[model samples]
Target chain A: MKRFTAICLFLLSVVALATPAFALRISIVPDHGNPASPQMGDRLRFHTAIQNDGNAAQEGVLAWISLVETDSGKEQPVDLEDWSAHKAVVSAALLPGQTVESIWPMRLIKAGSYRVVVSAMSRSGETLTASPFVDFTVRQKPVVESSRIVPVALSAPLLIAGLLIWRLRENRARA
Target chain B: MNAVAVIARKEAGDLLRSPRGLSWLLAMAAALSAFSLLLISDAELSLLDNAEAVYGMCAVIMGLGALLAIVMGVDTVAGEKERGSLVPLLIAPVARDRILFGKLAGIAMVWAAMYLLALPYLWAAGGAGQNLAEGLVSLALLGTPVVLGFGFLAMGMGARLGSTRSALMVCLVILLLAASPVILGPSLRQTAVGRIFDWINPLSVALNALDAVIIDSQAVVSQWLHWNLTLLFSGITLWFARDGFYRTAL
Candidate 1:
């Protein structure tokens, strides 16, 4: 009976020792959960939720969205200054079992395959957590835009020049 | 017909159909075309926000219009004096004030035409995304008075100097001073002296109002102070121009 009691105590101690001191869980999704189609100059919104599963309150945790272009052999980090004005959100204090949600809006400036993720760092700077990468493709906008602009650009000056010539000739004839 | 109307019509026809005036308009169109094409086709420039592109076009249009105004204003009395036609104009049935009003009207007509010419380019750049219409309205509201203010100031100087070359030189110097805000960086514009200068500078006021309306998406009702500055500038110039005409020697 003493051995049985010792075994029960040992099992309980192992379970407590294996458990993490603090748990920070995060998940990110595009606005509609489908990142199938995006284009240059399109505004894309992302929704991220951060939840604290630990026993103590969380404070001073920093969360930000990161974007990386993953176009085959050309992988690089995208600068978010033009894409978004506000990129980071800091929580003053998050109680245990409480969840915080944030929305990030970005304007796509280039066309390429990209992966975006949300990362969070703990207040004590010990633990770092990141959500799963959300992969998406941003297609190049059509060339029709240039074609549409060319006619106006060409014709406006020509029309003015024509008017000027005609007016000049008319004035000479009158004189 | 009123003396003002008669002189205004003749002056408008004379300048609008003149070779030099048409050359100015043609130059403006060419510059606008080049800019619009670059904005649409260039990979990097195309990435700018649609509203920002519109604001750029607005600034360009305003600058071109002001240049044309200065040219025409300096030519109003001073050009005629150089050609030995001022005496005949002064001895005509029109009062001096009516002649000034007539000249102002003629400049207004050219300015209106220039404004109309800028519309298609504005639409091409900004019609797709946002704030194109608001930018246009704000431009007209701010651009008209600011442009006319420069015109009247140039005319007054032309009357006082009685030499188109001298007036043109002085007006160009003043224009450079007015446009200095464009050369200064954003941080520098926030300093005490810069703030005071921008508040009084009609061109800066117009550009700021355009930025607020187009980029910041602020409502036009919030831009009353900017409007007041442009109007005050115009009023002062008109008064100066009237006094200039009264003191001029035929």
Candidate 2:
């Protein structure tokens, strides 16, 4: 009886150590169809996946998303408002062997390359972060068409003013 | 010594009499007031908001205050020389070190006076309900090193350049240095270049120290390392200013 009890206790300790208290996995899926570009007033979509890797259900998963600019090896936080994208937070309970997906709608208002970082935190204080930075260029649009019209618009007044000044100078010299 | 006192009094008198000096002071006051009001109004918006608003307010106030110090210092030496008044003072028996110390003392006094005048408004703003005493203590303690550092930098540049325009440019450089963290904080967190910038920049240190005080209520010992670094920088700059003054014809 004593030997059996000691064996049971040892097995229980191993089982306790093997069971994870809490585990989480996070990932960002970028969509090529709605590729993120550095164009003002452009919209894009991405998907985020969260999974519970532990044996038990995890509660209070709060998520946040931010766009970061990667430049000169630096990660700069791009203002979501300037990008015309709204940041949203969602909470859900994830049971073991279950996963949750969040669809993020992002708009690019200011032209720049950026990385989207999504973070999720559990009520028990476990946190996971994933970032997918996309790079693209934006072309500037002209205010008005036809460069030929620009010179005429700019030089007409100058030509008239120059002529008037020259005529005055000549009249003064003749006087 | 009475010589230092006399120089201090003279510098203070000149600062008060100059229109630029008064304008600088008013500008500092205005900046502080605007920041304080923004903090209070922001805080009143949501009770759930953290100490971010307070930190922002304190940072702006300290930044503007540092700028004002630079302005005052640029005029302290370079402007005087440009106007041809520095020659007569240079001829006097007063030690060059004393003159420099006197200038620093006068500028510090003006900064402190402006800071004190702005304190009430700060208190009435967001600082009233949340760790007001601690904030004031931190302000008084940490503010000293920052103001001293900028003052030394400004005076050194002014003495070396001997032209207010050049001095102003130097002041702008220092302002850029001080404001780098705000401009670069986001990008630096992920890049090697930003990491190096963060380590070398005095403005970054100042802002971090202020954050600790306002947010964590960390003790002065926690900030001693940064304060020591700033003091060392100020000492080196002051030494350089003295050496430059000795070499210059004034």
Candidate 3:
């Protein structure tokens, strides 16, 4: 009888000691900085921080960059071409209430308004019940381009002058 | 119905039916096209991808508008005299001043046509810009008056000269005079003459207004002084052109 009670107590203790995987609370801080308007084809860097606020240590976490649907405002599937970093990140013993910083460097491939989402998830497909996401938007670059104006400004006068000079010479020759 | 309307329609018809008019249309079509300019850069092409590129197109419009005022004004009075087409029109019951009005109205039609040709390019060039619609509006508000000033000046010179060659020379001189301030280096633009010219020159005024509207997105009130000066210059030049045309009509 004493053995039975000891076994029951031990099982209860063991059950109580192990935290359910769903109990881990993870969150990310949204960070958007300068050059929010990026030119097309420009390499861009994004910085974010993830925190594990629950009782369990989050392991084999990967920071993913995703495109948010412009109209639907929903996250698209992670794309390699659209993002910079694709590797899973393991936190250094990020126990309960510990934090980790992450970076995502990407190149802008197309020109249009874009909203990007940064999500941190556990590597083991089923362990994490919740994930953290950081969202931000950037506008197309070269909105105020003026380089092409230089040649036109200079050449317009020269072309007009040349035409007038030639016409003047033609008239003199005729006379 | 009215003499001005009648004459304007005839003039428009004449231009629309002629080879020179078709050529001008084609040139304007090509000039306002962004595809050619976009090809020059080989960047991913979008309507508003390179907003600054459209300014080159605008500059072309302004230059062509000036050239049109000058070249067409050669047909306004001096070319008519050279071709002996003026005497028959002078005998009509229309007032000599009305004849001048007809000419002005005809030029206005041509400008309106040019503006229509340019509208698509404006959309493609600076569609994403702040206050882009206002920048487009500046064409009507500021561009028209600038063209009027040059048109009237050209007509006045053409009336007095009554010969295409001399009038064209004078037009060239006027073009140089107006464009000189533009050709002046930035260092020169800081001087007193440049400052004064910047304030008064119609082309500068128009361009600055567009820059303020499209690029800077400022309120129209800030450009009021420059716009006012442009309109005033236009009115004065038109009045002078009418006087010259009246005297030269007989």
Q: What DockQ does each prediction reach against the true complex?
A: 0.23, 0.01, 0.06
Ranking by lDDT: 1, 3, 2
Per-residue lDDT of candidate 1, residues B47-69 (tens digit) = 77678888988988988888888
Models 1 onward score TM values of 0.69, 0.56, 0.58
RMSD of 2: 19.8
Error of 1 at B101 (Å): 0.6
- Over B1-250, each residue of candidate 3 has an lDDT whose tens digit, in order, gives 9898888776665554444565555555655443335524443332233434445456557767777777776678877888888889999888876777888888888888778766655665555454557666766787888886787888888888787788889877877777775566457578898878877777877777766765666776788887898899889989878877887875
lDDT digits (tens) for residues B1-250 of candidate 2 = 5777777777666544444455555555555545544432332222212244456656666677677778777787888888898888888888877877787888777667656655554454443345556566666666666776776678778878888898889778867865776976666646887767665666676667767876777875788776666676667766766666666644
Q: Any runs in candidate 2 off by more than 4 Å, and if so which? A: A1-175, B16-19, B40-50
Q: Is candidate 2 or candidate 3 better by lDDT?
A: 3
Writing each residue's lDDT as its tens digit, candidate 1 over A55-119 gives 66778888998899999898999888777776999998888898999998888887899899989
lDDT of 3 by residue, A1-175 (tens): 9999999999986765464444334444433553555665565665666666556676666555566435355435435544454434555455667677766676555544456655556643355443444444544455434344334433433443454556557757878
Ranking by TM-score: 1, 3, 2
Native contacts recovered, each model:
0.45, 0.00, 0.11
Error of 2 at A14 (Å): 64
DockQ of 1: 0.23
DockQ of 2: 0.01
- Quantify all predictions' global Cα lDDT against the true fold: 0.84, 0.64, 0.65
C-alpha lDDT (0 to 100) for residue A97 of candidate 2 = 72
